[model samples]
Target: MHEINWLPFWLTIKLASITTFLLLLIGILLSYYLAYNRHKINTIIEALLSLPLVLPPTVLGFYLLILFNKQGLIGTLWYKIFNKQLVFHFEGLVVASVIYSLPMMVHPLTAGFRSVPKNLIEASFTLGKSRLETLIRVILPNMKASILTGIVLSFAHTVGEFGVAVMVGGNIEGETRVVSIAIYSAVESMDYKTAHIYALILFFMSFLTLLALYFLNKKWKPYDKA
Candidate 1:
């Protein structure tokens, strides 16, 4: 029997954490714009953003690989500035994760924003509050459930990412060897015991995450403290 290496699990958690944080920030701004604006172009933009949800992970990962390869445009610029390659690096994994998990975060935030009372937003504006202030003080406070849902979904999605992470970041140990990849490697090596253990852990983690989300949604009233 072989002792399990816990590094991959830690790496997966780190990736998920970073991905969720970036997606939250990006999701907020994008969701806010999409929620309030009415324009033909916005529809096109929304569709592009949502493509990840339906696109195959490998397809998205392949595009990212091309875009961030040593000779690729973005890759070249990053290499010139950072003096290192993006492919097969931890940073590349983060970028890939943000893109892959974007819709998970944005969809919920957009729904939350739209669910807010339009009159409440107008009143905040009429009271001389800035859009930013209104968003922080009013809109966000009322959209707790949506925000929570987005964060959880993005985190969970990033944790389970395999095809995209492998294609963009490769399975470099201690860099991009996330738990999902670890499980695959174990299976390939005929280490069924290790793979089973990893799979069980992931199953429990995902289950608990979703269970907590549902529980919180049931208990966390948006205006309870307001």
Candidate 2:
């Protein structure tokens, strides 16, 4: 048995978890905006959010690299605030992962928000509930499948990220060397055994996560059905 340094795997999971959590929070408001409000500018906003789905990872990562550099807008502001550079750091990976995985969370959540009935929302308002209360007490509870789908997809997508992670985080050990980067490093060193282990773990883990999602949705929908 080749002794595996599990730090990369641990780091990858941590990144994915953090990204998914942040996306969930952001997606709730963003998805609500996209789903309920129709305006010319909303189209532009959604397009920007969805760009990562079509943009090449290296292209997106390159731009993010520049943006996260110490001289870049976000990076400069961050450096002055915390005295830390975002590039080639774990923080960089989180930011990159969030951007790269945005559509995965947002699209599903937007769909879920739209799936909610308009009357139900209005009724909540008529009953004197605020929008926030309706969202919390009504809409979200009804869209369990969409929420789970977004969470799983974002988490899975973040796990498999390679180009963005490499470009932004630079494969630093224990800090930014996620499983995908670790697999590439292992293969490059002719360490096929290590690479195979990581690959198989990812494959099975992703597969199982998806499988559980579908199963839960299938069983959940009938119960959640109005």
Candidate 3:
């Protein structure tokens, strides 16, 4: 048997961890904002955010390329201001993955936030809690399962993300090359054994994450009902 490259595996975990953490914060904030607002801009932003779900990864990556190219608007501004290039790097990968997996994170968070009872929100306000306090103490506490679900979903989605990462991050070893990209390279080289190994790891990790979610939700069933 060929020896496994633990580097890609560890890098995948790190990328997923960072991406999931940022996505969790952004997803929860977006969900909360969407839940409380009925504005037309919210609808438009929500539609745009969810657009990644239906769009092909290659297409999305192409647009990101244009958007982050040295001559591109955002890229030029970033470089002029901070002397940084945005493409073919870890930062670019994170941006791509976050955009790609946003819907998976946002959908679950929105569902969870919406599930918070109106009575609890009202009660918190009646008890003289501010809006921010009510969200932190009342709504978020009630939707803990959903929040956890969103985090797990975001992390898993990001770990398995390939096309966007490859197109934008360019498979730089020990930098932007995640497990998914490693698996792809293995297959490209006709290394089925190594590919299988990486694929199996991803499959097992995803399965276990979902299994934990299932049991966690079941354990929280009574609280959900109450």
Candidate 4:
């Protein structure tokens, strides 16, 4: 019988949940700008936003580590304010996961916002609805599928995070040892059984998430057309 350690799995859930929640709010604002803004710098901003999608996790984590180090800008500021180190903490993991999974949230949301009919937006403005009101009442309601996809993708991506998590947060057992790092440590210790269990759980979770997204999109296609 393989003994499963639930701590890492639970911790992964906690991290993914918090990351996804924060990303949802940030993603909506950023995506709205990217989708509608015609500024020349929009292209450059979009490229930077999408960098994480292509960048290696370890590479991103390395830079984040520097940024969150005691001597680093963000770290120094945080230390001065909180008198606590940002590196190797759960809060650090949350920050790392947010940065690492941002594109997953932003891309789909931008597409969704762009897909909203321009006429409907204009009509909303004509009816005295502010940009924020139109965004809340018209745009988001029409892009349910895309919003759901972004949330699911962001959550799953955060759950599967390893390189960044390990780099920034380190393997501090219950503190920062999420499922990905747990699997890595298990394998390194030749505990194939434990590693397999962790790997299988993540595999199924990711697979199901994508599956749900596809199914929901299909179901919503007719409504979206109407």
RMSD, candidate 4, Å: 1.3
Tell me the whole-model lDDT of each prediction, alpha carbons only: 0.94, 0.94, 0.87, 0.92
Q: How far is candidate 3 from the true structure (C-alpha RMSD, Å)?
A: 1.5
- For residues 1-226, write the lDDT of model 3, one tens digit per residue: 5898888888889889999999988998898888877898988998998898899899999898888879887678878887878788787788888899999899988988888888989999999999999989888888878888888888988998887888888988888899999999999999999999999988988999999999898887666545
Model 4, which residues run further than 4 Å from truth?
none
TM-score, model 3 to reference: 0.94
**Candidate 3 wrong stretches, greater than 4 Å:** none
lDDT of 2 by residue, 1-226 (tens): 5798899999999999999999999999999999999999998998999999999999999999999998899999989998999999999899999999999999999999888889999999999999999999999999999999999999999999999999999989999999999999999999999999999999999999999999989977853456
Q: Give the per-residue Cα lDDT of candidate 3 at 82.
A: 72
TM-score of 1: 0.96
Q: Against the true structure, what is each candidate's TM-score?
A: 0.96, 0.97, 0.94, 0.96
Candidate 1 local lDDT, 1-226, one digit each (tens): 5899999999999999999999999999999999999999998989999999999999999999999999998899999999989999999999999999999999999999998889998999999999999999999989999999999999999998999999998898899999999999999999999999999999999999999999998787646233
Global Cα RMSD, each model = 1.7, 1.1, 1.5, 1.3
When summed lDDT is taken over every stretch of 10 residues in candidate 3, the lowest stretch is 217-226
Output the worst ten-in-a-row residue range by lDDT, candidate 2.
217-226
List the candidate 1 regions with Cα displacement exceeding 4 Å: 221-226
Q: Write the per-residue lDDT of candidate 4 for residues 82-167, one digit (tens) a residue.
A: 89888999888999999999999999999999888899999999999999899899889999988999999999999988899999
